[model samples]
Target: MSHHTVSVELENKPGALVRISQLFARRGYNIQSLAVGPTERPGISRLTLRVDCSEHTIEQIEKQMHKLVNVLRVVELLPDESVERELALITVGAPPDRRAELIALGDVFGARVADIGREALTFEIVGRPEELDAFEELVRPHGVRELARTGRIGLRRPGPRQSRAQAALT
Candidate 1:
């Protein structure tokens, strides 16, 4: 039941996302987080999916994704070898007297004050899932008004050997 992140490159066409989601639904796999966007290649899109499953299940899921018509490539992003990020927007109760304290707390987490209403302050935070969770926990006592979090997005980092080889070629 460990979390796994899978990155898929696919055709940027209508219903592509729906089809991928259906595949997971049919297999009874719940997606923990999913993010899809256009890639540098104009006609292709990259999808980052986070799911809780065993190693065997993830292998099967990758194989199934490869068989889909729209999917071009599928790869598992290992935590130690990949860079992952998530964005969250949180609005908390902020009275005039507590504004500075809230702002200081946000600064500790590298969050920005997106808005400062009279009774509420909105913060924009971008970081790993755990970082966002910690920020939320600390701000909960301030009375969270609303919160929205984007799915995790990840990119695999090149290994040392690959980097060395590429450098030599350059």
Candidate 2:
């Protein structure tokens, strides 16, 4: 089995996420990571899903997804072609006598100290999955009390508009 990333553009409406998630669950495919957010268009949302499945299975899933009424478009985004993919991680911690050290370390990864409290400090970092992993590893000894992360989200760069001739061919 190999990992595949599929991006689905769907209408922004209630129960849409549920319906899409249920489609995957019923197929017994394990989703490694899923991220959904609003797109540039108003009333539209993009769903980025990373799943583990064989190539044949992925093709089958793609065909099946096309049958869904709410699904507007489904595109398989290749890593090299994708414009940007990012993950956000938020960590809260308090290292005794090591605040400056932690802050310095965070600075190296472009992480920001978002909040500070008597018992803990919250740091926010945005980067690729590997970067986030490295950041967490670096902060391990510094006393990371709690953490939350939004897994990878990606978008495909839009291509030039099709000419009238090309559109007619389709």
User: Which candidate leads the pack in lDDT?
Assistant: 1
Q: After superposition, how far is residue 102 of candidate 2 from its true place, in Å?
A: 0.8
Per-residue lDDT over 63-114 for candidate 2, one digit per residue giving the tens place of the 0 to 100 score: 8788888889988766555543555555556655777888888899989988
Residue 144 C-alpha lDDT in model 1: 100
Reference-based TM-score, model 1: 0.92
> Per-prediction TM-score, please?
0.92, 0.84
Candidate number of the best TM-score:
1
List, residue by residue over 67-122, the lDDT tens digit for candidate 1: 99999999998776677889999999999999999999999999999999999999
Which pairs, if any, clash in model 1? none
lDDT scores for all predictions? 0.92, 0.79
Model 1 score (lDDT): 0.92
